[model samples]
Target: MVTVPELEGTFIEVETLVEEADLSEGPAAVRGVLAELNISEDAFTTEQYTDAVIAHRSA
Candidate 1:
């Protein structure tokens, strides 16, 4: 995982595929992993991230 200070978050890489079944745990599941990494749940801004990705793609 790499800490992206600009994004105030880490870019984590998972070797295996995360299938639809994996989402069964919902948001808590994601929060759990982030907690294990010592990442705060508040660091994620969904709409902001979506816009950033779109802007990057358009660029």
Candidate 2:
């Protein structure tokens, strides 16, 4: 879990492996599951997290 102090917000990222062709259905599936559990996205991001992981591995 990570926190954004200024926004007083917190979030946990859930990841799944999906084929490139299934990219569209992937998000739909995730959103459907989230909706079933009453969860929502306030600020969804992939670029930042991907960059962070790459930088950390290089470091």
Candidate 3:
């Protein structure tokens, strides 16, 4: 996995490829996998890497 320069740490990204019509199911599916991996919902981040990088540079 590539390190996120802005965040200064490598991150894990879990994704579910649901169709646009089924977009609502994406989060629940990913959450299930994360739960299995022992990752709690409280640690989940919705911020994209590009957004993080921009914010870091702006700061």
RMSD (CA, Å), candidate 2 to true, equals 6.5
Candidate 3: segments with Cα more than 4 A from true spot? 19-24
Query: Residue by residue across 1-59, what tens digits does model 1's lDDT show?
Result: 66544454556632333568886556666777777878776665455555666676687
Q: What's the lDDT for candidate 3? A: 0.86
Off by over 4 Å in 2: 4-7, 41-59
lDDT score of model 1?
Answer: 0.60
lDDT of 2 by residue, 1-59 (tens): 78644333556666667899888888887777666767766455564655655666687
Model 3 steric clash pairs:
none
Write the residue-wise lDDT of candidate 3 on 1-59 in tens digits.
46875588667889789999999999899999999988888878888889989999999
Q: Single out the weakest 10-residue window by summed lDDT for candidate 3.
A: 1-10
Identify the leading candidate in terms of lDDT. Answer: 3
Look at candidate 2 and give me any clashing residue pairs. Answer: none
The TM-score, computed over Cα atoms with residue i paired to residue i, of candidate 1 is 0.42
TM-score, model 3 to reference? 0.69
- How well does each candidate superpose onto the true structure, as a TM-score? 0.42, 0.47, 0.69
Please say which candidate is ahead in TM-score: 1 or 2: 2
